[model samples]
Target: MYLKGEDISFGYEKKNRILNHVNLSLGSGELLGLIGDSGSGKSTLGGILSGYINNYQGSVSMDGKKIPSKGYNPVQLVFQHPEKAVNPRWKMKDILNEGHAVSQDILDSFGIKKSWLNRWPNELSGGELQRFALARALSPKTKFLIADEITTMVDAITQAQIWDIVLDIVEELNIGVLVVSHEKKLIDKLCHDVVFLDDINNV
Candidate 1:
């Protein structure tokens, strides 16, 4: 497995558990979706798998080795709200040029224009900002992406466009993706495998 969560369990309070016992595995080039109602610990699992929540029980590993806390690459998260994810002070070009190779074709596909690259986060509309966030996350050097409610703030047209860009990236890079969403329609459309949080209960 490229990524796997083994019998994981965790929560804010020591005695109160949000996720009971969860097990998940995804191989390379796979696109998986995790869905459930709010407070169902979906994002918590994302945090754990992405190495943001380390105090949880069980473990997360890549290629059979323990996933590192400090230097591990190849995994990145695109949060629901782009405003929350993006730095208001950074311009689009500054964000995208952080690491990944940028091209006119890539920008065109995400409905972004080269001319807008110099604009700050607040200058763009919500959907545009979210697309910029997606671009930035995908811009990094990585083989796996955790898209956590990536389309929540965008409209239908923008969401569809973003999904297309996401699929294109996954295919072009042969990357594994774990798309966490509460919307079943989007999951059915984009993911090859679906993992429902309600079935696993608290982990």
Candidate 2:
């Protein structure tokens, strides 16, 4: 399956534009690196591609059809901040359960401890919380993953671990991944191809 965004353009206000006629595509099992400076609207494009920003101009389609307007989305997005993603009132187990039932093997692969499931979001470390976030995003129905600087807030070792788990899972599941980040080493190391925002955006 392919998620294609054609002529995507959006902005919060009329005068200022963030994304302008940006085109991008990711097929199953492919990993694409999106590199740009801060405030370059990489994350905004990711959001539009994933159906989070529906009011934007242009079109995003899965295969040849538009994405579902409701229910489970095949394109899953893992944001930079895990703390803001999950419900702080709920325990980790419940939060993970928001998606499909994650297996013990999946937890082990992401280095998520059994004990961590019982803790609140506030109780776990940033890396630990991020692991759960990744697991939740990798549900069986997910055809593509839009990782918008997911590991930027973590330490180097933790970032590596997260990326390793993500790569392994995406390979096994044949899920396409669009990694939006400013990390040059990471993009070079993980992406099959790299594209810069200015190359495709008409802005």
Of the candidates shown, which would achieve the greatest lDDT relative to the real structure? 2
lDDT of 1 at 105: 65
Candidate 2: residue 200 Cα off by (Å) = 0.9
* Residues 1-203 of candidate 2: C-alpha lDDT, one tens digit per residue: 89999888899888888888888989999999999999899989988988888889999999989999788889999889899999999999999988678888888889888888899999998888889998888877889999999999988987888899999999999999999999888999999999999899888
Could you give me the TM-score of model 1 versus the true structure? 0.90
Clash-forming residue pairs, model 1: 9-203, 19-202, 19-203, 20-202, 20-203, 21-203
State the lDDT of candidate 1 residue by residue for 118-170, as single tens digits: 89878888888777766666643566788899888778987898788889977
Which residue window of length 10 is worst by lDDT in model 2? 97-106
How many backbone collisions does model 1 have?
Answer: 6
